[model samples]
Target chain A: MHTDLVAALDIGGTKIAGALVDGHGRILLRAQRATPAQEDGDTVMRAVEDVLGELTVSPLWSGARAVGIGSAGPVDASAGTVSPVNVPGWRGYPLVEGVRRATGGLPVELIGDGVAITAAEHWQGAARGHDNALCMVVSTGVGGGLVLNGQLHPGPTGNAGHIGHISVDLDGDACPCGSRGCVERIASGPNIARRALDAGWRPGPDGDTTAAAVGEAARAGDPVAVASFERAAQALAAGIAATATLVEIDIAVIGGGVAKAGEVLFAPLRRALADYATLSFVQRLTVAPALMGTDAGLVGAAAAALTRRNSATAAGV
Target chain B: MHTDLVAALDIGGTKIAGALVDGHGRILLRAQRATPAQEDGDTVMRAVEDVLGELTVSPLWSGARAVGIGSAGPVDASAGTVSPVNVPGWRGYPLVEGVRRATGGLPVELIGDGVAITAAEHWQGAARGHDNALCMVVSTGVGGGLVLNGQLHPGPTGNAGHIGHISVDLDGDACPCGSRGCVERIASGPNIARRALDAGWRPGPDGDTTAAAVGEAARAGDPVAVASFERAAQALAAGIAATATLVEIDIAVIGGGVAKAGEVLFAPLRRALADYATLSFVQRLTVAPALMGTDAGLVGAAAAALTRRNSATAAGV
Candidate 1:
């Protein structure tokens, strides 16, 4: 009557989250700690351990078979290390080894956060029934992952489907990542707000000048605000179309802060997609909002662990 | 000992070529016929049958175990049909069925010509040791194929790596493929010549106005010619970078006429790649000229047939 479970962790600059997830992806226990991102490597490790410490104490811990970590990248899944840009202290940090030790040498799997989200969507969200798909997050930065031939394709470095940084405009403005006119440069939340501000769209009485505010203004019929969102949509469409052309995906699932703007983003995005996704095979590609919400990373990490265990068992390894 | 061989057919607008290939990839025998491209579908198919008939009459015919067809696309490997743009008479033609019948009901496998070339590259050419790669042909048109996880990824319809039609410059000139600023629209051999001519670079007195002549002019220090090649390289860089970013390829193997321009095309391609492929995982991507010669399609088709037969045997199907 006992059910198998996996321990899952979602590590990002802002926080470290841990959960005990069952076979059906139900979270049985949860714990979290704010990331000491600005501190030294050891301090950040302490935060991750604190989150794991709480999970280990639960009576349900003994049922867990493995641990999965979905961390902000570039993570070296091959080398079991991470060097997140925002968390300078964690450069080349031995995250997998650290987590493995804390959990009594349980097997560990690590992937980029974007890939983890894609796994979650492919498992039980907008991309559930699709065999080939691209799932994306359009928050402060645009990050993404691919599901190819019905399996999550976390490339050798665990960073396939990093769509945000792909150049859509070869001669456009320079991005912080040392590229020009990347999708993230034009479609990320910050970029949307910045473009609107640069085009003379001012904040309201509350003085909030976020991308969300720009979305609101566009919904209220502000031409400059509308123009900024339209531009972001164009970049996203170009990137998405390029992905489909390369890998033959049938659907693109989008999430994160910018995607929450709903029709304000989706309408322009769909229209622009028609212009770029003109190939017969890609002409039928559909874009949909992601359904997993905030728990996607944790759930996806759990999915990765479960799938790995199943595959190994099936192979009699 | 009787060695098992595979019959491979490379069907194009101008020719229908057949080969009997050994396990070691050597072409043991060959046959070819001029394609009746402008004739009715039945007539074009008759040319293909004639090439196969010659192969069948060979004393070594009894050694052939399977057949593979690499034809101009878009081909539906699943539906066993083909609709190549250049062969207007073959729209939705039952190509696989016809070949199957022609070869005495031998098991047949079909793939697009681009995918076939990629199979050759992965099996024995420039892409040979790389696990994930993109192989492209930049001739009168741009076409390509992908190898992911060390296997040829001929997507559902056998056209996963059709990179030519993906828009790189969203606002640039329209392409015949219904997309704007496709890699082919700017980087194909004909486009390279057209761009150079439009920029006021005239051909030599020999009146040979091909992209090769333009390459010679650029090597001789014609600024306009160099600029046109540079522009083509820029667009190619964008498309190649996009492929690597989306799929995490470590190498891109380029073939065909434009790739033959040597450093005049490569110098700019490598430099422009630096501008677009800025991500840590993709920054190390290497560009190499394809090593496979004109027989790539036939050799690749043979490779596909051999691989398919091996896979089927291993599965005990």
Candidate 2:
């Protein structure tokens, strides 16, 4: 039979999105609901079911042989549970079983959101054709994932490439995650905005004090605003260089809101990378912008489901 | 045919040791030579040839099915060449080709010294049952390798886990490798001794100025000596935590001279690890001493050869 479709779910603090994705990565049907992030566990589960309800009612639902979930982490693929830092309502929640029952007992695969984005990048974006790569999202938090030896390395608990929390500055500031000098502590978009505002860079008529505003001020030749991005770039370069040095990745793909700052982040990032990645094997590493858009999470989840199905078929399971 | 033996070579800056190892990782025959490290390329080649010559004459040589060489960095297994920093006479030297010819064209594998030790540790030491681990040698230089997904992750160039060169303090002291504040720069034995001496810690009547003496002083309650080890421990902790956060290893196995300091180094390391490895996935990570002694490289090389031979046999090649 031509069971080539996969059901994908992208669960986050802000939204719960579901889609029926075909083998060519096209979304044939879609549904989404605002996450009841502050509600109780069953309330959040109800929102997830609502999205899945829409998906299952679609004419294309029967073609989906498997289901994949990309949830905000930390996820325990081994336990088929997730306890995303933002989703306190669902601590160690049985997401796989919930989704399995919602989809008529379809085989389910769960991975961290960062890993799902990496799968998308490896399959059809900036990291395409690269055997070893790092794909990052530098937005509210600096999350990332790895592609090692031409395959997605989701790690034992599906959180292998959690680069945001890795300490680059051992004696620097303390992170809310209880670690000091984490990359997310220094380089995330919120940190960038905070550093800029702390340095006396103010918002214009719009009264918007976001990182995007700082990016605008930096592009318009504001020294303090530029310096904040430079500092963030430095932290990112150190973290990226550390990853390359430890794992030998040939490319790094950057995406998300902060990455939209363009050369303000990239120019300094590239220059600082040269300063840190000095070893023979890692010196040749390159950085690029991510091509996958907002649909990356859903598409990547579908890719994961497709890969699992293919592997199980190959194993005659 | 039993095919119960493999020829193993552990090439380093100070010595070239060779052995014929049985299938159970026992060394039944051995050869050794002082490395002509400062001589021309041909002289060094001659020393290696002489070591191989002794192994070739052993009565059990005919039973060897493959050969493995574990040499100092930076090695390029893809190109079959090596350019160890201490051995400047052999820049991109064709070690693999030469060893292949010396062994009468026996299938050969080459890996960095750190990777070789990791293979040994995974086979029969501290990391034996762990599917993912980082094995480190903290001596004059800090070197390490990774075992991921129950296999040695040598990377494309056989140098994936060169952790010493990754910078933890991006703006701190400059490293000789053209990076700033690398783990090796801050945590190596030489640096530990230098920091202790610079802080006015005096040697005993024996005038022993090594890290071992520093360890002795720290054990004897010298504040200066303890502070120096604490600083080294901090750098190591940051580096190790960074590794765990990026790749998700469950344990870190430490060996070599400085690791011999016991609680003086490990106590501070474990404490500092709690400060950096705070993420949920990495919080459970443990540190242990490597069990393989001085014969790690040779035995690990033998393990690599055996694994390769067994894989080839399975492939019917």
Candidate 3:
């Protein structure tokens, strides 16, 4: 790795994806390991430490400067900590401090895992070269980030692009976010599986009831599967149209495990957008897939570090 | 007046509003006149000439350094010209040059009327102190502007906050923005009035059926009027919810004549937003009213000029 490279770490509930990214935005060194996520916050942090130790010992990484971490949920980017919803034991965890210690006191910046993935896409994946766009990860959960008017919007509390929680139905299911009929309740990956299971399609295993499985069943003419994806598509389309109207995004890039269903998810979404979008100024929009795969988080963290570095230089410190 | 004050002119289809605002964000002088909107382009420009002429002659505004004009409909802010739909024959009218000659070589900046209103609101109105918000005018024709992350977003074509053209229902109505089922077709003042009248509710003749009359009737316990306002309220609410998901706006400042119905329009609108929003992050939104009333345009124009002056200064002019 380059001597002045920035180290990036992706922290999730199940695993860790780490890499060293260069100035040209390419990954030169990498490491992966299981997360001690079921343990207390300290144990999970120790796991991150072990992985960073492995990367530094490897010959591939000659040198590393600072560190960038992408942590999960309700992040306070300015303060550099996170208490993600899915990760039960990490309430108000000082993630940046943990990673900084793991990297031997190297400066580190923390952002929400979802926002980091989107930043990765913008840096070198599907959304590269585009200034105004939205990046969504439709995996175990529905989450997103936005580069609007060429700037990132992390919100007052650093959770601006929580697209899944936007309610589509007033009389629909109650959500954990203290609302009813949110897009996540009706259309997220787990919800999609639940919808099929409720229709008695028995996809064998609960784990087998993925968005891709539903798409396949729908392609095979399963009414239940077709209805399920259409509902998801409709909710997603409605959310997209509303967002486009407000920010005038030029493109929307979708990623994550569920996005593997592809057109089953996008086709109906486009049709729904056409129905609700009345402005003829921009007759069509470009809604497609994210270029970054699983490594999105690591790269995004690197990018975040780079941004901080630039700001620091501009400030003459 | 500040020595470098710019004369601002806002020519809507129905009326002409002008002001000589100093660089300190103060309106030093103001005036208004009826617009002979039915007349052809040249005839209408003659009216603009007359109004601007009055501003130059006033003892409080004679030494203006530059000029700015705001108008409704498809405008090329870069080109300083427009084709205002409501102003009968204003097709590609040389509005900037005409005003420049009319004001004797004073430089001018032209923008969509919506952008101007947004600038005004952001500078010092209902949306003051907000980093992200929308200032919407739901009157004779729907218009709005977006303030995102503390800066204005005018888009590639200078129409970022054109909320009226947003399509909430594909099966809805036709809009002149060249699309069908636009929000304006169902939620604008004219549509509200026309729909109210068509439903057999006779409002006092005020040249058009409008949201104001519908608001009045709803206050008086007219079922039909209440339903009409509720319909518009629902549509506006849905649109606002969609917007919340994308931009993470903290507030939506409702202006224009129709918004004056206060809670008659706001109450149902808030309920609809609560029902339609999909994200937990986006649902925490607030709605308010424009503080400047009809004077918003003049104030907004001066605000735009002030920003331009600051930018030019920052650019070392």
Candidate 4:
């Protein structure tokens, strides 16, 4: 009855990672496999099974009484399914059932990858100790999750804090999600680089055309690059402020590639936040960079599994 | 003891109302008085006490177990103070302590008026049975509250869902709240009327330039008035979609003066929602008019008090 470890899986288009994590979040064992994202559903499930197979054979797996999954969404926690946009072959994949079968009927908890990252931040990273917060990953695409009332609010379908899709401009630009003026349409790393390129900011001799290169140009005082970042910052500020105005969050933690731009992103974001977070209760909101790094998804999955086990135990289930 | 009733107070700029409400949300006895909003702090407190006095004098008062106050914010449930914007004379007034002293020390619960109305909607009105919903009032100002995981989300300051001030158009227009293009600035009844008039819509022979008049004109095929309502609908849709995307609400219930515009607003709102709420998870979101009437504030306050009483009882307090 010394069940102090949880099994965790981080499934995305790029990889399928599994781990056995201890009570303090240390990974006792870890395994990963490249995802054949374009393959059939069964093939993807097999890769996931292979990764889990690695962890399951380890002695530490015996202590893992429950399993948690952080999968690319849109995830339907109610239906125990996921249909990640980047993985076209896995439409409505029954991930929870697959994982449960692979793990000898261990209780499996599934959440969107963004929600998983938020759980990590809330449990041990930038959002730690904050009762109400928003944790975001601004990369090639922007994604996020919310921590409300000292708990991770993954929502019914496990995609509660998808802030990137929320319209901040209402009429600015069309997003692939079929929405107009979405934060992702204007604020994602790809969009920032695109805006910079469109605004006549050429890449250096290396001919790199990514947001990271644009960040360099911005640091060197390139007006077009700086303006692009400023626009992205504005969109982010509006979205973050809107979140705070709606839910009264006190902090927003940003991670991912775009957030690595540091003060080039933070300075303008702080300025634009004042313009949008004007309501009295929301005026004191702050923003910080996320600290959980690349292992957030794995650790957050373990955290979710632990929380489920604890709650079930408390309820005498 | 037969402690099944709660005292409810609805404090606003225009009125101070009180009621003795049964566990079933029915108002058994009521009292009301005009709010001398411009008067000093003590005067406002006296008006509230007078309303409470009427409820306390009734023979049913002995059955009231607790008190709930739903006041125009910014009300700080944590600090037990309220500083309603329209009531400048009562800056940071300790209304909770005042009510506590007046009610002979009955345990009290305080919430923003928007939260109170949401509680009413969730408990007995349009949002009944929906675990996750946003209830909004779209009259002189747009205000809202959220129901998440089957409980009211009033936030730490009792002002979580102040969606009116959220910027839908971050750079469009200056708002009194210092935000640009806030939902209230574009969608409130006053703004709707102003937009109609500014766009060359004239009043009828009655010479009334209210939003109600504009609604009548739009119904009569006046393009200017119709266009203004459409604009307001667009802003509302963006804000509503943002709420759904961030929190995964299944329904949005709208009430108050402007909602009386009916199809003139709802038609365009539904169309715009289809445009903004495009994510797979949010696509199923529905919009409805609120069923609770003016008594929502009172009923919702009672609902909060009853919930508090029940939780306290469960905790054996």
On DockQ, the candidate that comes out on top is 4
Lowest summed lDDT window (length 10), candidate 3 chain B: B170-179
Error of 1 at A140 (Å): 1.0
Cα lDDT tens digits, model 1, B1-317, are 34669999999988899999988889999999998889999999999989999999988989998998898888888788998888999988999999989999989989889999999999999999999999999999999999999899988778789989888787889999877888999999999999889889998899988999999999999999999999999999999999998888999999998899999999999999998888888898999999999999999999999999999998997
Compose the digit string of candidate 2's lDDT tens values, residues A1-317.
33699999999999999999999898899999999999988899999999999989977888999998999999999999999889899999999999999999999999999999999999999999999999999999999999999889888888988889887787889899998878898899999999999999999999999999999999999999999999999899999999998888999999999999999999999999999999888889999999999999999999999999999999899
lDDT of 4 at B121: 99
Across B101-146, the per-residue lDDT of candidate 2 in tens digits comes to: 9999999999999999999999999999999999999999999999
Error of 2 at B203 (Å): 0.8
lDDT of 4 by residue, A180-226 (tens): 88999999999999999998999999999999999999999999999
Residue lDDT tens for model 3, B232-294:
887777667656655668898998878888888898888877766644455568999998766
TM-score of each: 0.98, 0.98, 0.83, 0.99
In order, the first chain's TM-score in every candidate is: 0.99, 0.98, 0.91, 0.99
* Alpha-carbon local distance difference test for all models: 0.92, 0.93, 0.75, 0.94
| DockQ, all models | 0.77, 0.84, 0.32, 0.88
Candidate 4, residues B175-281, lDDT tens digits: the string is 99988989999999999999988889989888999999999999999999999999999999999999999999999999999999999999999999999998889
Worst window of 10 by summed lDDT in candidate 4 chain B: B1-10
Tell how far residue B225 is off in model 1, in angstroms: 1.5
- Sorted on lDDT, best first, the list reads 4, 2, 1, 3
User: What's the distance in Å from true for residue B49, model 1?
Assistant: 1.6
Q: Write the per-residue lDDT of candidate 1 for residues A124-209, one digit (tens) a residue.
A: 89999899999999999999999998999998888899999888887889999998889999999999999999999999999999
Candidate 1: list runs displaced more than 4 Å.
Answer: A1-3, B1-3
Q: How many angstroms is residue B90 displaced in model 1 relative to the true structure, after the best TM-score fit?
A: 1.6
The candidate that wins on TM-score is 4
